[model samples]
Target: MPISSTRSSASRIPLLDILKGLACALIVGHHLVFYGPMSDVAYPLAPDLMDWLFAYGRMAVQVFLVLGGYLAASTLAPQGVARFDSPLQQVLRRFVRLSTPYLAALMFNLLAAELARYGMDDGSVPAEPSLPQLLAHVFLLQDLLGFEALSAGVWYVAIDFQLFVLAVAVLSLARFLSVRWKAPWLAPVLVLLGACASLFYFNLMPELDTWGVYFAGAYGMGMLAFWAGHSTRPYRWLVALATLGLATLALDFRGRIAVALVTALALGVLQASGGARHWSPMPALQRLGQMSYSVFLVHFPVCLLVNALFNQFWPTQPWANAAGMVIALALSLRAGQWLYQHVETRLVSMPMALRMQGGLLVATGLVLLGLKAL
Candidate 1:
């Protein structure tokens, strides 16, 4: 099968974009309350609202996991069998695409943290990065290595990359088997079984949470959803996917898993019924969706800056703290736009080898500077 011909060139799915935008906004709000001192000031005014946002808002990441799986399947194996040349090359390409902007954002975050340090002492201020810690983060192993994260939500980046590589491997295995067995449904069945194991077994183990396997259930659901949506027997596959997801949740009830299942089902139905077209024409939300990754990368530092400033200037003013949250949100969006254009777009266009060299150069420079400062 010719690669491009089997690939799905489905029009940009507006529904998915909308969901991404909404999830990004929730994540930003979650960080603002979870990280900043400003939330302390605003909490008394709206305790219930603040508590909810602080507690459950981070679950928005489930949305991204589902979407990532959907998009990965759509690109790599639209018919549920990998057609790419080399999984290693695919992994390298994805690493570059994710890490280039990630490194650039870390630099900005370090600068912001330094500047914020001069303003106030609060939990929001991350400790100064050591040379080793910086290196760990550069390799996206800070969490696994037990180093404190330089920025909030960075764990997701590492996990996202891991999930992509794992998915590619599974798809590649299916492709290999397809050469021997000419059954068109063999690949999808194998992938679904893997997903079931993830959901019912791996996901139940909290110790595996740092690894992609813990979250593979949800990510795999997204992959299954994508294939199911596009299948010739769309209704049959969609029903099967939903039933499996629900059964897994019933076996081991997790609120987050429930949320993931719902998100996956919604995305599957939207794609199946062509509801991914212009159902809701919110341009701003669509733009947010486009920049969601950038927003995720940079929002923590932006929130830190605002929190430091608010504590310094209006420590007792509750309303000022509320205003600062709004300012932080706006600035995060603006910063995301700047980062996407100057950092993400440029690096994504470069060859993988060049991008890796550039990232290493930047990381080495930052680490050396941090060591010197210490």
Candidate 2:
């Protein structure tokens, strides 16, 4: 859900990285318990902990969505004005950057799922992908086109792309309106209105989840937090951000939205207090945060692999399955580190991204076709 190419090494915000890291860990833990024979076997040992992780751990995504918006704002529209001349170029670049690492990770996931299926017959093992399903995923359209995701959290990748396009379009139009009327308020006002609309209307409809508007509330809040954080009147902007979120909750409560609101607000406060820059984070947290997107993308396949191993060898050993959860987490972090270094850190172009995605599709299709033949 995040690969912030916004700030450079020197300008990186520790707070953002720390939060993203913590959120990434929760997301991984949540899935370890969720997509598991491991967690199923170990559940009786710590039902309350397992229950809580399953129930609320996924909400950590709200943190990523919010942080993604915040970073997007910093990169795309720091001044609440459109910086890019061509919105298409901005979006295309973002797509390329996102998809490069994404397709690489998808390739790993596809192989991992196949390996897991070979090992165990759990329902969580994604079935062999059809051609159309693979094509939709290549374009980050699996969720939009109603294909079963090849892996968990794939929908978020599509939604992230969609939300970025929406933000660019909205802010580009705001720039046009701002110049035409000479009103600075047009940009933030439009963004705020979109956020309000989502929080009040679109977000309530489960059907709209595939689109950006459904999650625009949190994303917009993050955008606004950027503007507000750098504003002359930071507290005033903070108040407005808080007020909008509170109003939404007062009217119709949603725990996910509540987490988003809190995350945005926490970021705002940190930025306002200069803690975003000055706070020294532990090395581990910062490293994890820096590679949070990598972890987010790759953790699922690792979890599935570990779960399959447990299913095959230690299916009835509760303690062993519990240890498998830890093993999965360690392996996930290692896999993410490798992905970050090998793929995410590369200077990939549009062509390269397309080639990787094409390779992913062809390779994954071959695996599926081979299985069918057998």
Candidate 3:
């Protein structure tokens, strides 16, 4: 659901961006098919294809998870040492940066939901949000608090935040332990052990899905990829990564984990082979990748609106609905482009980000009040 960029263009990896673009496209398609009436109407045309997408499209999220980890490691601790002065400050900054655009997207989603309610009586349109629900989303605690997500894939945002915080904490702990033990290798070793624990234990528990530890293995694989890419013994690191992932699957096979492991390993291989550094940028793909976060944030609202239109005016016509799906996708990209340019790319200050969050809460109140009156 996310990514970061701190490196200069000259230092950036083209392949990662290209992969992100592809993964973002898959996630968008997954939601388009999984959520609403468009896919339902078009199902008979391609039952197998629709089913396949419904079942596996979400695996793209693992790609994002690995990518997020890779980028986070490159920025947070490229050399496996904590670079920031304060973990709290770094975490808070990440929260602010994430929520600034997120809150705006939520506003669009809330409005779209209301509009969708009038157009279709389907389950895809979210129910009117309560105060606690709105607040949960504002604080990125919706999943932990057991609130129904107001939009598709928002859980990933909360999970992304949790993963980042977890990463920061682990790195800080590793730094402390390294100093205390007088062993520089402890940082990477501790991280590796933690990732193994997550894969072997925490990741297997469905009840812990809302927490960072549940997804730490995939993210850790990404972090390890960074270290491996830079290490002289890249093959050893790659073998260790593959062994851990494969062993986890041997115990309990999860296709998502497989995707994550493959993504991480591929990234490690690319980084090790210098492909990551020398790859030529595909302009279209890289652009899509750069704005993929915005695409992820805004696509739901665009999808809702398109689905509503088709449901209200053109119910159950296969070709029309399929084409509407295409239109929705195109509109989603356009909306994402607008959002990336207008709201997401802007450098929001702490004070302004706070105000935006406040605005989100206030807007949600107004919408709920309107719903009640109606």
Candidate 4:
């Protein structure tokens, strides 16, 4: 049976925005506790809470991976077949969308780190970046190349890109086969089987965690949920997808997989019931979700700055540290709003943007090299 296409709409989904807002908050809290000395001071007061946030807050990223797949499917190939003229072009477009804001954030963080260094000594300050390291980051290969990250959570940016490219490639290949053999089911079936293989086999191997295949299981679950929610027999497809996901988990239990499965299922149910479209309007949550990517990109530097200020001024007051955390969160949101407005929403031609990014990368690398020599 052919999967149904999602109804086209310009309005953003409230449920999705709410979820993204929540995820961004969790990630911000996680970093607040994990990266800075503020957490150390507060740990004596709320040790258990601090520990929990430090440990599990990072898992919130699974929500993003799942949501990304769902939205990618909704936008790129709603009927479970590639619609673009070239998958490469689609990938390039996504790369530009992600990279522009990312490069701006990186430069901002670099400046923040330098300023923080003059204020006090702290672990939150990243080491001065080398030319090679900057180049690796420009290409989104820092983690894979074993170079130290200049900022927290930047690895996810690279991983997001990888997962997107992989998804497009898989769907594009399936589309090619379907066209060649004149079998519509062939595309969906092949894609589904590939997802299963990812869940059962590739996800089981930890060594591949840096690559998209490692997270393809979770990402694929999102893709499947999108199709299932829009399918003619929505319940049947949802149950089938859930059963497959559960079976994979049963074979090799993973905490992350459990989280991903639940997230995907929740998204599927929401989409199927029209709940995604009809949720009570929340302007605050909607705004947060709209700027979630910008928030994710810029929050770390804001946190780092707050941590430095707190350490230099208060040093030992728990209340001061707590207050700093609140201030950091507020500033992060404001910064995100500004970034989204100025950098993310601004229109630039793809070729021009790519060229600008490439030029900036070379200039930054040269400056880093000159600094190393000095």
Runs of candidate 4 exceeding 4 Å displacement? 5-12, 355-374
Candidate 3 segments exceeding 4 Å error: 1-10, 363-374
At residue 197, give the lDDT of candidate 2.
Answer: 96
Give the alpha carbon lDDT tens digit for every residue of 1-374 in model 4: 46754443324568888889888999998999998888888778788888888898998999999999898888777777777887878888888899898998897788778778867688779988887998798789998999999999899999999989888888888888888898766655765787788888888888987788788888888888887777778788888888987898889888888888999999888877865676846779877988999999999999999888889999999988988888999999999999999889877779888887777667755665565566
lDDT of 1: 0.84
lDDT, model 3, position 118: 84
Clash statistics: count for each candidate: 0, 0, 0, 0
Off by over 4 Å in 2: 1-10, 366-374
Each model's TM-score?
0.92, 0.94, 0.94, 0.93
* Candidate 2 local lDDT, 1-374, one digit each (tens): 11122322225568788898899999998998889688999999999999999999999999989998888878876666767899999999999888888887887788889889877888888987887998799889998888999988889999999999999999899888889898766777898899999999999999999998999999999988877777777778889899999999999999999999999988877776655686765779888999988998999999999988889989899999999999999999999999999989898788877777787778877886686578
Query: Weakest 10 consecutive residues, lDDT, candidate 3?
Result: 1-10
Which ten contiguous residues of candidate 2 have the minimum total lDDT?
Answer: 1-10
| lDDT measured at residue 130 in model 4 versus the true structure, 0 to 100 | 84
Cα lDDT of model 1 by residue, 245-280, tens digit: 789877978888888889988887887676556587
C-alpha lDDT of all candidate models, in order: 0.84, 0.86, 0.86, 0.84
Model 1 / residue 342 / CA error / Å:
2.0
Report how far off residue 253 is in candidate 1 (Å). 1.6
List clashing residue pairs in candidate 3: none
Off by over 4 Å in 1: 1-7, 347-374
Candidate 3, 132-243: lDDT as tens digits: 9988998899999999999998898999999999889988897888788876666678778888999999998999998989998998889888777667677788898899
